[model samples]
Target: MAMTHLQPDPSPYPADAFAAFELLSSAILVIDDDGLIRYANAPAEDLFEVSVRQLYAVQAGDLFRDGEQLRQSLEEARRHLFADKRQILEIDRLGREPTQVSVTVVALDGQPWPALIELREIEQQLKVDREERLLEQAQANRELLRNLAHEIKNPLGGLRGAAQLLEAELSDPALIEYTQVIIQEADRLQTLVDRLLVPHRAPRIVGDVNIHEVCERVRSLVLAEYPNGLRIVRDYDAAIPEFRGDKAQLIQAVLNVVRNAAEALSARIAAGDAEITLRTRVARQVTLAKQRFRLALELHVMDNGPGIPPELLDRIFHPLVSGREGGSGLGLTLTQTFVQQHEGVIECDSRPGLTDFRLLLPLP
Candidate 1:
């Protein structure tokens, strides 16, 4: 909404003054000199989760969770302390996630309404920005690792060969054991290098993939591994149409995510209370890999377990960044790579009791 539009009660300012703001995407609120809400545009009503008439004569600041900060801004507007000020704050919503918004408060010039407040939802914008950064960083990581893998391949093979030859020459059992350790460690590193290079391999086997099929495969695999004490629940969206993607790669991506969730529930597994859910839904007008798509498939792996540590959440998708003690940490990296190959994106959100991993792939 245009904060610059003259605003106030209908009696003081004509109805036409608020006409243009009704079409605005941003939310606009006009407060009288006493800091009471005189008018709210259509967008504002949506933002506040209330009607424009319901907001009338209400204290504008009281609408926010942290109203004191907004109240101070409104007070400043009434006294003409500053022309305009902007701040980021959260808007409280009942039974829903709080909306983070960029609020701009402008002191109107010689108008009946002294304060013009603009609320722009930044959550979606933040998600887009974050997704873009993630894409860029993942690309850089892939390039760096691919180059490193190529450089290490020859030396890694040589190290294993030298250890094997040294072991043959040593008749002494003790010396042979040392060479064996060297060979095993070299092989381990080689395996890791191979995993790092897997994403660089092109020509994925693409086909019309049923998302539920992929989830079922992963679910059965995970349930087999944790069968005694864990439960894998299916919440499939049957209406989701088949999309073109690499079936095997999609299965691997989903497997990695679900397996990770299972691993995280290790503690709960022993107690027989661990649960993992495979939920699928159809999303419309969603953005993935910095590109907007009309339709997309959303697969969520939700778990009730001890969540990922806060320190490692941001880097979980990076190569060699695992939360588990013995984890090689390439699962999520490869998962993201596979999803990105299909013009999709993966996101994670975790807290104390719940951890959710969502994969978004464009639908044909």
Candidate 2:
């Protein structure tokens, strides 16, 4: 949606015509020479979430949430308008929900008969500005993830080979154990690097597959990991249609997210508080990867734990960023890449109390 704003045009009224123009402006309001509101502008309607016609039906004193303060400000504006020729005041309008507005009062050049009061809504402007910043940040992250993953692939192979050679040359059994550790660690790194390259690899197979089957497979694996302490809940919409995708890739993608959630909840599981819910539903008029589809699958992995740490929340999908200690962090990155390959998108929302990872995939 296009953002809305209240902008005032340059006043055509001369200093003497201040009150007259104030009455005509979409923002200006005129009061009795005593500064009681007698007229308001169209824009004031939005500031109060009321009709402009209803504005005058109510007294200015009755319109302010803080009526006494508003009355005081009006009195001050009245005192200053005639003396200084103009004054700026902040007034809070009265209602079940009150609105704060900035009002400017200007005295007419020739007569003190009328005063001008301008109304504006600053809150709406701030909301739009914040959304713009968030969108820009999300875009930058996507680009960074793509570039960083590509850059890390070359050195990873050499490290893996060097560890393997050192493992073969070690003579002492105990010393060889250290080399084996290096080899194991290098192999783990190799797996992560391979995951980073998954998106670039072509899908080996594609066919119609039921999403629920995929979910169930992942659920079984997760349940096996936390058989005693964790609970895996399924909320499936059976009405959802099958989609064309690589079955194995989809399983791996879903498994990665579920496993990560299970890992994150390990402490909670030990305390008997871990609960992971896998929900599937169909979303209409869905958009993924900037393309709109008439219908899409919505998969949610919701966990009840301490939730993701605040500092790492935004970068959760980026390569090598993880909230978990001793985590390689490629799980989510590969999950995202696999989903994206199928023309899907993944989003996450995490706070102290709740964390939800959502995937939207286009249906066949």
Q: Clash totals for all models, in order?
A: 1, 6
Candidate 1, pairs of clashing residues = 1-26
Candidate 2 clashing pairs?
63-93, 63-94, 64-93, 64-94, 65-93, 65-94
For candidate 1, write residues 210-314 as lDDT tens digits: 988888888888878877889999998899999898999998999998888888888899999999989999876576766657678888899999899999999
What TM-score do all the candidates reach, one by one?
0.70, 0.56
Error of 1 at 44 (Å): 14
Tens-digit per-residue lDDT, 1-364, candidate 2: 0112324333333445444532332366566644444455554554555554565534465554455554555566566534323223344444433444554445444544444555544453354354345445545655675576567656766776787787788788998888777778777766765665566665658899899999999998888877888988889999999989888989999999888888888789899978989999887544354444667899999998778887888778777788788887778877876777687777788876578998889986
Candidate with best lDDT: 1
